[model samples]
Target: MKKILLPTDFSENSWNAITYALQLFKNEECTFFLLNTFAPAVYQVEYLLVMPQPDETLNVYKESSLRNLEMLKERMQTEFSNPKHSIETISIFNTLVHQINEEIQDKSIDYIIMGTKGATGAREILFGSNTVFVLKKVKCPIIAVPETFTYESPHEILFPTDYGINYQDEHIQPLLNLTGNNVARINILHVDKGRGLTEYQERNKQQLESYFKHSAYLFHSVQNESVQEAIANFQLKVRVNLLVMLNNKHSFFENLFFKSTINQIGFHLNIPFFVIPTKLGKK
Candidate 1:
């Protein structure tokens, strides 16, 4: 059975993401872990050193987190009552990324479905701080749903790559799994910056082709435009439901996403984004 980890803050944005995940894998047998992490607003050294009393703020935060998770689970059961999906709730008094890593390891999570923005996310920002941190720090595959995006069949996928890192089977397995489950057409986009593909890039590109040989895909090239522009124009031309990328440090993923000013991004992402992590120069 597929084990999927979902971290929620009990916000509508998180709920929308959860619903999207359920519909995305409705036909498959899966276990969904709903996780909520809480920390005290004020850091007190004594809070950690001493045992928690009933009236302590730590207990209060823990109770609220557990209560909210249970409520969310009940709502999921009522709204998306799928027999193929089993729901589990987790409430921890830990940091978001830390607990997420723990759950991923303990539960053997396959994928993480989360909102691009959090409860306090700004509208102009493409991704919230938590989402960005996970995308960079966590190695597991993630599917980030836009807060306002409604669920749709991912029939068309847009994958933009610079072919900087070597391709691995496990690195591309998430994309493979999605394509295997859905009749999706992948549009492999390569943005040309006047410099043609190098010998190494050519070999990596060929490896990608071999990986997706069984899936329906087409190679697309755009010249004299930024990667952001190419992606925006491509989405305009084709009604893409999902956007995918391999988050390699050497790739364009960092330059396009890891800007100091989040709002400076040129394109507005409206579809679900699938991020597959790969180490730098991983063979």
Candidate 2:
């Protein structure tokens, strides 16, 4: 069974992401883990650092978290009512990223689906602080749903790559599963530096094409432009529904996100971004 993690803060944005995930995998038998990471307020955390036992106020926070999670689960069951999916709610008294890391191994999570930024997060930051943290540290494939994005059947998926890493079926299994299982088209975008593909890159490209040979696919090559610009223009041109990218180190994915600000670079991801980690830390 596929195991998917849904981290929520009981916000409408997070609930929307959960709704999207459930609908996306409604036909496939899957287990959904609804996780809520509750951290004490600033002053309370400082106090807890000094005190061995959490005070009554801390217990109140824990109680509220558990209650909200249970309510959320009930809401999911009432609204979606999909027998193929199982909802498991977990409420932890820990930080967001830290708790997410712990659950990744404990639950053997397949995919992490969440909103880019939640209600409490500032809208000014392109990618929320929590999302950037998870994208950098977590090793699992993550699907970040933009706050403004609504549930739409993804007919066109844009997978931008440099063809630097050798293509592997296992690497893109998540993506291929969606496109092949459903009536979706995979659009592969490669930004070239005026120089054509190298011998190895050409082989990798062929291998990738071979993987989706039976499915509807299109490969596009744009010359002499930054990867971000190419993605922006192509997304606008095609009106892509989903954006997929492999987060390989020292690549465009890292350069685009591993920064203080994303808006400073003149591009903001408006669609759901499916990021697959090139390398995952061993459990």
Candidate 3:
């Protein structure tokens, strides 16, 4: 069965992501693992040694996580009525990012679905944290659903890349799984800055071309505009249902997303975004 790991903090944004994941894979038999990580509210330090009574704090957190999971499950069953779907809940009293990485390996997670925002605005800004951290750190593919985005069929997918990183089989597979004989049109968009493609970049583009040669895909290029603006305009003109990007450091994907303000992110992305992390290049 397909195993999907969904990390939640019991926030409305997290629940929005959960509902989107359920509907996205409703027709397929899948097991959804609902995971939540909690840390102690207070830590005691003595002689430069910090101690946390994990057991004391975790019991209540576990209870609350379980209850919320049950509530989400019931709502799904009542709304979708899908018998093939199965769900499991896990609560960990540890750092969120650390626990997520550990569980991704331990549980053999397939994909991660999560909320773009966290518990509070301050926590989101100063730390430059939350789902963005998960996206950069996690070795698996992540589908970040905006809190306000409603579920929609992925009939048209907008993929923006700079042809910087070489495409890998692992990176492409998850996207293919989502598209799968659905008659979805994949728009492979490349934004040029007047420099044009170098010989090396052309070869990389060919590599992508060879992979999706048989798939219903098209290649397009737009020049003289910023990557973010191009993508936003493309979505508006084509009415894309999903946006896909390969997050390569210093690439347009990174600049347009990683450096932008959180509230402004939705301005560019009205649809759900699937982020595939590109392996860092050796210096």
User: How many clashes (backbone N, Cα, C below 3 Å) per candidate?
Assistant: 0, 0, 0
Alpha-carbon lDDT, every model: 0.85, 0.84, 0.77
lDDT of 2 by residue, 1-283 (tens): 8899999999988898899899888889999999997775674555545665556777888899899999999999999998899989898777777678888888788899999763333444656778888989998889999888888878999999888888776588878777755689999999989889999999989889888888889999999778888888897789798999999987778888786666466467778999999886454
Q: What is the lDDT of residue 111 in candidate 1?
A: 92
lDDT of 1 by residue, 27-125 (tens): 999999999977665655456336333346478788888889989999999999999999999987766776788787777788999997633444566
State residue 226's C-alpha deviation in candidate 1, in Å: 0.7
Candidate 1 matches the true fold with a TM-score of 0.91
Off by over 4 Å in 2: 43-56, 118-124, 261-263
Q: In model 1, which runs have C-alpha deviations exceeding 4 angstroms?
A: 44-55, 118-123, 280-283
Arrange candidates by lDDT, descending.
Answer: 1, 2, 3
Provide TM-scores for the models: 0.91, 0.91, 0.86
lDDT of 1: 0.85
